[model samples]
Target: MSDFLVVGGGVIGMMTTLQLADAGHSVTLLERGRCGREASWAGGGIVSPLYPWRYTAPISRLSGWSEGYYPELALRLYEETGVDPEYRQKGLLYLRVEDEARAMAWAREVGKPLERVSADFLYAKEPEVAPGCQEALWMPTLGSIRNPRLTRALHARLSAMQGVTLREECEVRGFRQAGGRVTAVETSQGPVAADQVLVCGGAWAAALLEEVGITLPVRPVKGQMILFKAPPGLVNRVVLMDGRYVIPRADGRVLAGSTLEDAGFDKTVSGEARESLWASATRIVPALADCLVEHHWAGLRPGSPDGVPFIGAVPGLENLHVNAGHYRNGLVLAPAATRLMVDELLGRAPILDPAPYALEGRLAGGL
Candidate 1:
């Protein structure tokens, strides 16, 4: 038995493992399938949400903290694992043909460096940008990472660690809870005992918690994305549209996404959703007209009503913790979320306030 048994192997879970292992804890990660192959690998890679200034102050703070940590985290992973997380700081260029005043106000409030651009400015900067795509908010601090690479690097690092054990293709069937705390986890293969347990099963967190009679307000929000093989610097920065976004990668690929649907555990790609994403992306960058579709996939985001993640102890269950319900910002908030989770597990004071991510409120009958 290890010190901690972490269920789920996405960015959040892996990052949590990194923190725990770095703190000299014996950590075991269990994945139902391949590590980081789920939502973490299939995200748009936007490190921050569109219009983050409109969010609550706490949420904004968490995202900003995560954004700042990405560079250091990437560097550490690269140095140790010999795999670059490909974290790039190519800021987001959010365009808004509508609500220019609101955009300006938000930029000023958040202290984000933004410049108003007209159609001529767009044409001058990115000639491929659509003709009607005028007026944009450029945030220099925004950036993205190669999600798949980051996940792979984390997996490799964990595998190479002496005390860290990863059990892949191990679907957790239930939990062994006694005295109001989870003693161990029962998986399809066998039971693994540990002093502490953390459930970080992204979109499946709620269902996994139910096996232990704990209820968290986490639901699967399906997102469909499309990737295009455009030139590397075709769209240098992330571009945002009405509610959609386009992320350019360093490897001559651009990701366009996504449609938010409350589809339960459905990872199937939809033709209609693909068409919608294509239209939305083309509306922003028309040059994608000739781009070849390289990849199309879907992922289930663990969404909560308040748009904040559940990243603290499991209520009424000592030694049981949670680090899920990040929704779309799972990749963005992975670093901060994992650190706070490990702190809770180790009984250390958290650097960031954990109230917003408290898991007690959602417990049945308020625990």
Candidate 2:
């Protein structure tokens, strides 16, 4: 029996598994499909939330903690695996805001380095921006990473670590319980006994827990993205207009996305969404209108009812914990979330207050 069994092979599960294994625990991670090929692979890789001011306090806490930890983690990953996740401090520019006052106030409250720039200043900074965007907010401390690359690096690093086993193509069918504790997990291959179990199944978490009479409020939120191949230095930094964004990678590839749709588990990319995203991209950065659209794809984000992820022990179930429901911020929040989960599992002092993210705590509150 392994000391820990992590269900789901996304960024959250992989990070949690790595942390546990590094802490001298026997860990096995099970994934229905190939690891990290889900939402973690399809995200824009923005290290900060799209609209930081709009999210609740708990969300901010996780994002803040992660923003500080990702650079060091990326460096370590590169040193160990020789795989660069392309963690970049490119910053974020919000092109339009309905409540600029509120945004500025929130930035000040959070001690974020935010500056209001006029249209002329924005154009001087990023000449490719569309002409009509007259004002913007510049967040200098925000960063991004190549999500797919980061996931690959994590998988490789975890595989090389001692006492870590990754089981891809191993779909967890159900759980075996004894006296309200999940003692073992039944997989398609076979039953694996575990001292503890963590369900980080992303969008499928709710359905997985339902078999045990637990209803977690998480669902699949489909988001589609389009990729554009442009010359290097085309879009200087991440640009945001409303909720949609355009992220420029170091290799001259720009990612423009996405549409939040309640489309269940269907990840089909629609023509409507493609055109909409293309329009948004061109509208934000006029130069993108000329760039060749390489391809488009979609992923399912684990949408939560309260927008705050559940990251603690399961009520009434011993040796069973949860670390899912991160919605759209999984990549940005992965590092800190993993630390918090491992801290709880090891009975150590938590790095942050656990009340806001408690499984059964009140849904409304902030840090």
Best-fitting candidate, scored by lDDT: 2
- Where does model 1 exceed 4 Å of error? 118-121, 364-367
RMSD of each: 2.1, 2.2
lDDT for position 317 in model 1 = 80
Q: Candidate 2: deviation at residue 99, Å?
A: 1.0
lDDT of 2 by residue, 230-339 (tens): 99988888999967899999998999999999889999999999999999999999889999999999999998987788899888888888988899899988988889
Q: Alpha-carbon error at 76 in model 1, in Å?
A: 1.8
The 10-residue segment with the lowest total lDDT in model 2: 358-367
My TM-score estimates for the predictions, one after another, are 0.95, 0.97
Per-residue lDDT tens digits of candidate 1, residues 163-245?
A: 89999999999988788877778998899999899899999998998887777888899999999999877887787878888
Q: 101, model 2: CA deviation in Å?
A: 0.5
Worst 10 residues of 1 by lDDT: 358-367
lDDT of residue 325 for candidate 2: 87
> Which lDDT values do the candidates have, in the order given?
0.84, 0.90
